[model samples]
Target: ELTNRSFEDPPGSSVTPSGWYDCGFEGETPPDILPSPTLNIGKTAYHRSTYLGLTVRDNNTWESISQELRQPMQKGACYQLEVYLARAHSYWGISRITGKEANYKEPALLRIFGGFDGCDGRQLLAETPTVSHTDWRRYVLQLEPALKPYDHLILEAHYGDGPMPGPNNGNVLVDSLSNLIPVDCNANPGLNKNPEPEFAKRQMLSPKEADRDLPLPVSEAAKGEPISETQLLELITTTAPRIAFDPAGNLEHSHYTDPLTNKGKWANLLLKNILDGLAQHPLAILVIVIPEKDPNLAALKKQNLKEALVDLGALQEQVILRDWLEKDVEKVWYGNAESGVLMRLIR
Candidate 1:
């Protein structure tokens, strides 16, 4: 294992542990040890005690911590490098260039490079997709030096080129880095370059061609000849009424009673709309689908909403409450609008 692999020794602000050199831009801050307990950020280090934290700034500048391998990598040998990564959801610091307060939450990525030079060679080895989650996750990179031997490895953290707009500055945490370990490459044929040729040939269908070979789409399969007028009328009569409310709206408040008059007005407007729908379809069922993770919290919201509806003359038995997982709803509803409760007519 690499020396000081955990980065637990000689710890202090902007300090790089022994055996690792801070090769980032001059005058810029190097990776530092994150304090334990990571308060207020809602994350914990993958390993107990301290972890390494690196930053990337608005101008696209980044930081890195590197080390020269104690021994040169053997050519044609398979190695596996593993590291744990997490995003710093929120960070507050002053930019060295602008000297302004930099508060942002952006994604950070880990790129591993191996080369002949000390740590500055340009050969790319392996890179991870952006590490954007606040929770710690492990990433592994398989390395097989085909020809030239590499003497150094550099670990970099920086922003990815994603179109989604976000704060330009961000931080990422690195912890529990494992040394590149040699594995039995022959035992794992998939990891080795010598996989059976027949196996590769079996998976050769292009995506477009494979999609063309699939059965008819679900929408087409469900489609049938047009219905008669009597059948359509019966279908219309059996369909239930629905109304939707924004999940982020005033109804999400923890309190049952509206603290502000404007909130009460908004609640009343939603209740009035639901009541009108119920009146037009007196025999139809009233189903309320709220997008929430917690069933208990959703039930509470339903109870509060029902009470508001009761004030508007809606009977308790006429309403049904349900909680739809947000992911399931997103699969069906493609609207870019903000999250909300979706009440829909159903049979």
Candidate 2:
């Protein structure tokens, strides 16, 4: 039910303790004495308990810990704290296969830390509460002026040194350490956490968006701009006095146009395209072959002859000229790509 969570760290991940460095692992690890600090992987804190036995990966790295908060949370915020704690821990044992141990042992911690700051990597927040036995328990903390709510939380061995083995190197099992509080800052300000979303969108569409619905080269862009919609439309509708095409797909018109002219642009465009195609060769022709020799081919040819009337969904209906290629492809003569004579035919 607690709303507080370990920010920055994903749930049940060892990386929860990111953004800081140099900290103690356990209060009192059994059998030997060694501390090299900064561990790879398994660097997160979780809830555990001897009652629940060792949580598979206990392996000792299961010491309870917490992340340092960002800053001073707003004063009057509705706050809730949920700590997944296991008053006991047993990630490892001094018994069985001891690399260099004679006695196996693990201890439960008093309290875990939560929502804290000061990252010299040696700061402690809320102390864990002491627990006993094989059962599990949950606890909540209310922010009060008297106790002065802690900004951070830790789930490792309690702050002071304890003799019962619940010390710095001892095992501490904690499920999750979280706190959720709605800050009521007097001066509300927007948080700048992870701003890549906005920047990413801009970068993705910057080039294409710059030309959309815009006349090219009008403002900042140096590239020649697209013609105005009105001008382009007018040109599409206008018939040209004469048209010529060049090797490059461009139109050369004898008629001069004033600013904002679009009188015959589309017709001009169509003609220009034709000229462009023809420029590549003396003549450009499309020939479609419909066989007339074999019986099956003839049947297919007959079927093609009925092309003007194509099936139009429903049961079947006459196909419109635009809807059927046959009417437009009457072949000036009947032939296909294989006919040398048909290939020479032009519209």
Candidate 3:
């Protein structure tokens, strides 16, 4: 099951909703989680208090959000999800190309990408033609990953062929996503599996129900500057003094960390280390080592760690998860050991 599937996380003009990470360009602002009065969209949410607002700008860049899935999507498997989509004709933004205010009223389409990381966009799984409706409408997207398996999903707003063809301002409102359901790949495509009148009722949760299990907002006192790489290295060295090292004093493995055992202070420290590292370097990628024994449990373990990190506000592109034994025979899971999580610097 997906966490915060209905986009129930709190909203802000620039803040990425909880459980989702921004995947916009380097210099671009992140997508807005909205229903804010300041945006002046003059729209109520289709489901709860807020919805996702994505834009395709004239500067050839667009907005998107991604999250690591609780379960990896199996290759060649078919999955469908229901969501509400609408177009806000009064949406406005400052155009980068024109250097002035402009209406982002043009319709935009939704593009879904699946990959092994939070923002890889390795495979384009599904795309809608365009959402031109001013009222909330239900859309069931069918995704079939024909290539490799995927553990992450991305929702992107893209330009559509409107009356004026070239790149311009466009906005799409997304809300109330249903659970991702697997179906028969060969079944008649585009047919609604559940045509009952109460289908919509089941998709949307009440406000009280939506708020349940949601993470509490981070207070100002809990926020601070991220730690530097140098600081992080020192922390690891000081905290894990018994860690095995090579002749050159480089890290070989940690004696204190055994993912299956000793799940207390050391584990929390390890999580903190990861959180600090990702916060400092937002673009870095993670590499999770999947062991041969109980591969399914290993996948679930990785998902749990991912959710933990995301819950603590770590939003970088996560590691590409795989069964190391099946993918490679020469390279060991963690240099010499059988299991552990590895963080790699992409630079």
Candidate 4:
């Protein structure tokens, strides 16, 4: 079970709240317990009156809030972790001189890390892409701790590689954290089995009605054979190849020399296809991979993709954004620049 899931108790404080502790940053300030609906931030917590607020600095320093679980999470158990997160969209840190809010556009970011030792021995579990939304959005991740039981979780906020810093600061708000719930991995509900119910009913159509209503399948690719629905479902429910976007933020064409007329359009179509697949596979989790090179550029691309998905009505919690180190990228898809977002379905 989780305590203070909404950060509601110990009322009206800007310091640490009850049942949670500030995970220090060694010579930096601790996280704050702030009123969510304040005039400055202008948003309420997903659940209650208050939420945890954290900041990232220009020097790359950040802050974190952590809690020790009521019971240890069992090893190898599949558990769902959910939280509501939002970026300030515009916030300069608490002013030292005037104590007033300064306006800025630095993107607020949050990463979830789990561990056996109190906020130490942690491994990067899941994180959001550049959080630019002022509204609170839910984010979910399925955690299967492999080697040991984890009793602690940390939520760290930082300035992602994008967004120029003002007085070296950015902020993120967090609320409504959920306790881990074990999932029955083998159970495939009929709802999931029939991904598109309305389309499935099309079989009831008379041949004449079908001919009039259903459009013929049009293949777009020039060479590859079409995949079966079963294959498509498998691809949606299982892990996929790492997709890398163009480093220069060009979603339109694979290369500058490529004679593609609708590069951007194709990129949007690819994203829409992935979103459609996820909608069919409700249990599937979406993860966005961000490369380490040029954090600012990576952050911007991540934010843009996330915004596009959000516009398509994807829940913030159902998707995860993670950063990839240069070495990690090379290990998988080496020398590919035009690749777009990579996705993996949670097992």
Tens digits of per-residue lDDT for model 1, 75-177: 7777876676777776666765588986646777777777766558455556777777776655656667666788888888767654433336777778767
Candidate 3 lDDT tens digits, 41-113 = 6565654357889999998899999989988888989987667778988887798988899998899988888
* Model 2 worst lDDT window (10 residues): 193-202
For residues 240-345, what per-residue lDDT tens digits would candidate 4 score against the true structure? 2223332233222111111334322212333444555555545656666755466666775676566556645676666776676555444433222334455545
Best by TM-score: 3
CA lDDT scores, all candidates in order: 0.55, 0.29, 0.62, 0.55
| Candidate topping lDDT | 3
lDDT of 3 at 124: 85
TM-score of predicted model 1?
A: 0.50
- Model 2 over residues 1-347: C-alpha lDDT tens digits? 12223222332223323433323444422111111122211322222111111111123343333445554333444333434333232233332234443221234444333343532223232343443322323434332212345554444444223344322234333333334444333322322111110100111123534332132111111113344433332322331111222111112121212234434111222233222232233332323233233444344333432331221111122111112245545534321222111111232
Q: What TM-score does each of the candidates earn?
A: 0.50, 0.29, 0.55, 0.48
lDDT of 3: 0.62
Best-first order by TM-score: 3, 1, 4, 2
Clashing pairs in 4: 138-317, 139-317, 140-317, 161-295, 161-296, 244-339, 244-340, 245-339, 252-263, 252-264
Tell me the deviation in Å of residue 76 in model 1.
2.9
Which candidate would rank higher by lDDT, 3 or 4? 3
Instruction: Single out the weakest 10-residue window by summed lDDT for candidate 1.
Output: 194-203
